[model samples]
Target: MSRVPAALTALTMALLLCSGSALAKKDAETGAEPNTQVPAGSRHYAATGFPDRLVASPAQDAARGFSVAWRTDTSVKAPVLEWVLAGDSPDVGTPTRITATTQALTTELGASHHHRADITGLQPDTLYLWRVQGQNTWSAWNQLRTAGRADQPLTLLYFGDTQNKNLSHVSRVMRAGIKAAPDARLSLFAGDLVSGGDGQDDSEWGEWFAAAGWLPQETAVAPAIGNHEYFEEFEDTPQERRVLGRHWPVTFALPRNGVDAADTSTYWFDYQGVRIAVLDGTSALDLGTAKAQAAWLDTVLADNPHPWSIVLLHQPFYSPREGRENTELRDVLLPVVRRHQVDLVLQGHDHTYGRRGEGQGATPQFVVTVAGPKQYRLSDEARATMAPVGEDTQLFQVLKIDPSHLRYEARTVTGRLYDGFELTRGTDGRKQKTELTQGRIAPRDCTRAQTLKGRADRCWE
Candidate 1:
């Protein structure tokens, strides 16, 4: 027998070892398992549809109630949820079971069922474990904590436009935000959760839910309706003629205190002395519902008994991007918000970070932020008016509110604090705002040399 060359043998062994190492690394990164029995006509990510995308939202009363939404295969006729007060161990069994209201629909990914269950009678400041039962399987037990008393302090995680490049880019920021603010009572999204319109794109929604991990199972989510959430009659049609996607109302179990059944996306919920109101900007801008929503907003704010009020919407009254202004929306909603003395207005859709109302006494602080990978140049107007204009950086905001003070911090995707402030209320119900950037990292700006590199530029260090 002829002996093989030693160098050739070594090279072959090295190649095999490198291939094995790469496979191992990929597996560790993805936690993906092989499925040999992928069913026919099922998308790669839609196999089994075994109760995925589980999310918890605030019910009518967050302190005593919570709502959960999940998806399963269409075969599941009667979905159910079982919950119990979580003890110290997973051995706790046989939780109270409740039937979930389900809606069956066919999407681009095929036939699927969406289930929502409103679990009430929960004790405030208590932890509970819950799981959903589908056609023949039950989801793993997920734990959630109820809202505390009105006087208790509250922390909330805010993200702007997790619309483009959700899984590849935005997932890290979502995970980091959840890790950094583990005690946050709720997660607030400033609209454009997905880039696709009319819910025709299942992959984007899948990336969004998958990136969120256990957040939806734990903290409640309040998402506003962005323009991207609406779809035009055809891709060639004008944007102002768009309509609300069918999936918005069915996927989220939000509060129903809006103008009408079709406008339920505009609603409000209170938690720990703070009332958060979400408005459907797409509906208001495109469907001529601005007047109706503004009336509803006034009513909600007038009836609110909380110490702090935060309004969330997609379009900003003070446009952050140049040549992009929603004067109609601003004209109608700004007066109502000012009349009610809203503390903060979180917005998105400009794909940049900006702040207005800094020196205006008693005026609501308006913020525009972007959390996804997509970036846009600051409009000339934004550069002239907005402070700390963030262009190339993905960001998230951590907000803490108490009876006397409200703290706000904006951080990059890599967990660096970029901008922050503190708002203190005086005895006369006036607010004194203070910037909290002492010794903190400065804002990031891209240089001319870096800008030449196109999207590959790393503007912020």
Candidate 2:
């Protein structure tokens, strides 16, 4: 063999390395290896093993317990959480550690892991710092405050569907809600958290989590599963055949004391002096869980240990739109609510703002609101029944509960009070409601000439 030039040998080796790299890139893009993990650069938001989508939910007991759920890449087989008392100064000491129960799931993006840990033995009304550990990394410290004992005044923030334009439009509304009620212990989501196909769209979920920011980690969330949570095979398919999204159960570590142990989405929890029951309206109407949920609701209400009771569902009994009537759910669940004299019914799915209830007696007040950019025109029925039907507007609500009274306020995205009311219960058990909005603002009508995206009459067809 003749002696080759040193530069020529180096050039030949570099070309070979480049060719190999190109082949590897092509194989990754084409998924030539089924078991190979997807490249992080190709993933939506490039999710990693470090915790993301952190959400806290009230545990079996809110006063001394709570749970946190987060997602990580598949590489993290066992995730752990560490916590210590939150203080002004950094005190180096051993902290309580808890290992999370994890589930491996393959999403549309790729394989991922969901981890949940229930932390108990916490002190009431105390703040704590916590962080989650992945295989080789740890998340930044997050703060959590336990709920005060019963009879203590509590505040909660309520939001409607954040399914459309979540990151761009809905994020502002949620941030505004948190800023308005800084002391709120929990945030209630009225469902339809995402509006992607089959509810497994990784980008949509990423946007949803990004819009939520640090709020979910700080304040606990109680969410209901809306009709959008269920994916239909075809538009012509029957409602009874709809199926829940694959991410519904794994993403949320809700209370499992519901009627069907398999479905923890429908459950109840008591905080302060109020009892909140989360019902699966989609399951009730489509999955043949109505009767069972009704029975469960009756039993839960009958055995209630709290004076104030509220029901959270995705669909409204009194539909805000013309063709969105959920007659089956109303027929089966309304009777139970009436019998129990439920204090309030918070719902979503209409995409418009509505409020209707009988102020005379024990009828549960109903509210339908939307928090995202998607808006729909209110039907004639909504206009006739709802006191202040709002369209083409995003809103959030704050509810303050005390021993004898409850004050509720609805505000627009910019923090303007749109509607408000107060409920007072007397010693003799007589209840009265006083409307707080006295011609403060007119109902938003999209039919009027309004410019949106450089188009006139954007709210109507």
Model 1 has an lDDT value of 0.78
Could you tell me how far off, in angstroms, the CA of residue 252 lies in candidate 2 after the best superposition? 1.5
Model 2 C-alpha lDDT per residue in residues 268-321, reported as the tens digit of each score: 888888889999988888778899999999998898787688999999888777
Instruction: Say which candidate scores most in lDDT.
Output: 2
Off by over 4 Å in 2: 1-42, 198-200, 233-240, 448-461
Against the unseen true structure, what C-alpha lDDT does each candidate score? 0.78, 0.80
TM-score, model 2 to reference: 0.86
**Which lDDT tens digits does candidate 1 get at residues 133-166?**
8768889988888888888898999999888667
Q: Estimate each model's TM-score.
A: 0.86, 0.86
Q: Model 2 clash pairs?
A: none
Error of 1 at 398 (Å): 0.5
